[model samples]
Structures are given as structure tokens and as C-alpha cells.
Target: MNQKQLVSSALASVMALGLVSGAAAADDNKGKEKCYGIAKAGQNDCANLAGTHSCAGQSKADMDAGEWKYVAKGTCKQMGGLSLAEAKDKTAMMKK
Candidate 1:
């Protein structure tokens, strides 16, 4: 190919790559489903990240009562478990 054509092709390839990479999904905050008159609920998947990461949102009652303090955050590949208390502790530390 001519010099100009080759350069244009390279530029197009780089732009395409950037678009693909940027399009990848990012970690999103979990969603809270309002727990009405019900007393208890089971584990619920909140968000799916990159076909690997999955999370479980804590109930509103637990958050308000501070009874079951915890949230699930991790990827399907490398998941690090965290309890509500532990998460609170971590957030406190981060604020410092």
C-alpha cells in the first residue's frame, strides 16, 4: 500500500481498538430493592459485570436496622468476600 494509505489504515485500527476497549462495561453500584411487608428475603443478584462479576444487594431492613450489614462484591474470576461490618470498616479507613 502507499505510504498515506498505510498510515490511514494504522490510524483506523488504533481508533477501533480504543472504541472496543472503552465500550467494556464498568463496575456499577448495587441496586437496592425495597423490602415491603416481608420479613425475610433470599440472596438476589444485583448486577452482572463483564459476564464474570456478580453482586448481591442487601435488604433495606438490614441496612436500616444494621442487623445484616454486608454486601457482595466480586468478579466471577477473582471474588473477595466482604461483610457489611467489614465494608463499613473499609469505608471508614478510606475516608481517613
Candidate 2:
């Protein structure tokens, strides 16, 4: 194949790999709530990010301190929240 063709193939392969890996990671992270958060006023819940599992408080604070959009209402669900593996197991059981 020509250089351009070769480069195109390589890029496509890398992108596909990235997508697959990302999906896998997300699957692995299922159910684990992000640890960090400032919590919303009187809500008793914090927005936990899906990816890093980090609480939304820090992210929200970085995005905008006063904006109400930063806060998503709801508790982490579990008592203190489950780890990724635990969450996945719980999810699997629920599916059954």
C-alpha cells in the first residue's frame, strides 16, 4: 500500500483500539461511585463521574463555582458505594 494508505489504516486501527479499550474500561468502572465531591446543599448527594469515578464536586467547582448546573442531585446509591468489581457483580445479579 502507498504511504497515505498505510497511514490511514494505522490511524483507523488505533482509533478502533481506543474505542474498544474505552468501552472495556467503562464496563469495568460500572457501579463504583466517584470518591470526591463537595455535595449539593441539602441534597445529601453528589454527582459522581462515570469514567474516573471521581465526584462531580471538584469537576463542578472547576467548571463554575456558583452555577447550579454543577450539582446533580442523588446519593451514590449504595451505603458508601461499591468498588468497580462489586458494582459489576451487583449489576450482573440485577440483570438476572
Candidate 3:
């Protein structure tokens, strides 16, 4: 292949590799569930449904009952982790 064609082919291969790796990472969490009220401050996996923050590890409070992290399915409750609904209710109750 010509120089230009070789560069394009290499770039395409790199992009395909990135896509494949990302898909694999996502698949790794397929059977996981989001467990709330268990993440320590600045250690959350993502933003809360309550719109508290916009990124991971951005929680301002430890066990805020709003943030969540991915845990094995059916294990959240056993681990004393709350669901989104339960967390929200608990937060509401705490405010009163």
C-alpha cells in the first residue's frame, strides 16, 4: 500500500481496537446493579439521579444515600446497600 493508505489503515485498526475494548468493558458490568448509599465521598462511580454531580468520584458526602456504585446483582441488599428509591426515601426522611 502507498504511504497514505498505510496510515489510514493503521488509524482504522487503532479505532477498531478502542471500540472493541470499550464494548468488553461495558459487557463486564452487564449483570451488575447500581447500589446506592455505599460510596464514600469522592469515590462514587457516577452521578446520582438526583443530579448531585456530573461525574464519577465527585460525591461530597460519604454514604450520601444518593450516589451509587455498580455491585453484583442481588448483593446490594445483602451488603447493606440501598437502591435508588430506598436511598431517596431515606434522604427525604433524614431531612425532616
Of the candidates shown, which would achieve the greatest TM-score relative to the real structure?
3
What is every candidate's alpha-carbon RMSD to the true fold? 13.0, 12.0, 3.8
**Model 2, global lDDT:** 0.44
Q: Which stretches of candidate 3 lie over 4 Å from their true place?
A: 1-25
lDDT of 2 by residue, 1-96 (tens): 899999999999999999999899767656544422223433223333333333323333332112122222244332244443554555456558
Instruction: Order the numbered candidates by lDDT, best leading.
Output: 3, 2, 1
Best of the candidates, lDDT: 3
Q: Could you give candidate 3's per-residue lDDT for residues 10-71 as a string of tens digits?
A: 99999999999999989999999999988999999988867968899899988878889999
Specify the poorest-scoring 10-residue window by lDDT in model 2: 63-72
TM-score of each: 0.28, 0.40, 0.68
Once all C-alphas are superposed, what RMSD does model 1 give against the true structure? Answer: 13.0
Candidates in order have lDDT scores of 0.40, 0.44, 0.90
Instruction: List candidate 1 stretches off by more than 4 Å.
Output: 25-96
* Candidate 1: clashing residue pairs, number: 3
lDDT at 43, model 3: 92
Q: Which parts of model 2 have CA positions greater than 4 angstroms off?
A: 37-96
